[model samples]
Target: MRGVVMYKPGDVRVEERDDPRIIEPTDAIIRLSATCICGSDLWPYRGAEPVDHQVMGHEYVGVVTEVGSRVHTIKVGDFVVGSFFASDNTCEICRAGYQAYCVHRVLMGALGTQSELARIPLADGTLVATPGHPAPDLIPSLLAASDVLGTGWFAAVAAEAGPGKTVAVVGDGAVGLLGVLAARHLGAERIIAFSRHADRQALARYFGATDIVEERGPAGVDRIKDLTGGLGAHSVIEAVGTQEAMMQAIHATRPGGHVGYVGVSHDVALPGNELFMSGVHLHGGPAPVRRFLPELINLIWNRTIDPGKVFDLALPFDRAAEGYDAMDKRAATKVLLTL
Candidate 1:
């Protein structure tokens, strides 16, 4: 089987590896159809995160080729979308819609979805099959639901965005941009996206943002407050996990507003006094995508939302290196790898 491996930081290779097998009874072998690199993947590629000489890439959609005897909900030939965290649906966390925190969790990137094949453990609980079979048009939404969309949705939900609420989005990465769309779909009355880029700003408007702020840090917070009649937004989505973005989100909301944060957290340390004085509700972490997959699929199937707009660059799986480079250089909002 062919796979992309990161031998070390800045060194990524598409090479051949022994095909994976059912090492556990709950495993299921799958043939990947589409997969893409994620913004979070950059953390390791840039050497900020540890890079072991192992496989890379996580977001994927595939066809099941084999299922263990213990797996009954899914069988061979089923096309499915699995969460980054392999979980048992019946577990307490999963039952509470927090499968990403399942008692037994398997990180998706470690499983390497950027290959011709993959072995999905906890098959019945981790994978969600499309009703019967999904058409090609639905692929992107299914793919998005696996991560970015789910993350954005989680952020919006955490921020408490809903009808009559004024929501402000901080950051313009794929996830941040998608947060604009999620806030709109969730019924926010006003959305302010803080973006300076022409392309991302345009998409933010298309996603229903009523305003765009080009400022950064304090200036941005001031602008948001000015736009919201000095009360700040009722809800704020913090899609960038940096100290600045996190603080901006914390301060961009009303005294009692909620802040939804879904950026892959890094170097963030919030002081107790700051949060206490702000009185802003903060909630978000690795999105439990499993919880949103069903409704996301339904909305996509009905064409209510198109989360796939995040995919700005598409390349064959073999050119995974170029895909990574483009994103690393900020030349692409996201890169989709075609299998």
Candidate 2:
């Protein structure tokens, strides 16, 4: 089989590799139908995250080709979507709706989904089978439900975006744009998107953003405050993991508001004194994507939402390097790899 492997920072290649098999009784093998690059993956591509000869890619939606003896809910021939983290959804932590922190968890990127085949552990709890094989066009959206959509949804949920709430999103990437969409779907009365790109601003408007702030740093926070009558947004979504983005999010949110940060924090340290005085709620980490896959799949399957629009580039699985390059250069919001 062929899969993507990161040889080091700024280097990734599609190379021949051994195929995967069920090494655990709870594992299942999936033949990739589609997969995509993630913003977090860029940390390694840009050398922020150290890399050796490690498998790459994680977002995936595929067909189950084999199942281990312990797998029951998922079976061979089932079309499934799963979170980046493989988890036994029934664990005590999972029961509390935090599957990303499940005591028994496996990071799927360790096996790499940007390949023709993948081994999914905890198949019963991690993989959610669609009602049936979906149409070809639906594949992209279904694939988004596996990661980006679920993560964005989790951000919106954590931010408490809903009716009567004023929401502000601090990123223009796929996850951030989808956070806008999720906020709208959750019934946010006002959605403010921070972006300067014309295309992204247009897409954000289509996703239900009522305002767009092109400024950066303090200016950006001021613009958000100006839009909200100096009180700031009721809910803020921080999709960029950086000190600047984090502070912008904190400043754009009103006192007693919520800030849901989903960006993979690279080098960030928050001041406890400021946080204590901010009078705002902060909650984030790896999203519990498994908790929202079912509802997200339903929305995508029914065409109620089109999160797949995020994939501005599509390539054959073999051209994954080019896909990575496109994203690293910010030429594409998201890149999808088809088998």
Which candidate number would show the highest TM-score if scored against the true structure? 2
**Every model's TM-score:** 0.98, 0.99
| Clash counts for the predictions, in order | 1, 0
Candidate 2 regions exceeding 4 Å error are none
TM-score of 1: 0.98
lDDT of candidate 1? 0.89
lDDT of 2 by residue, 77-175 (tens): 999999999999989999999999999999988878888899999999999999999999999999988888888889999999999999999999999
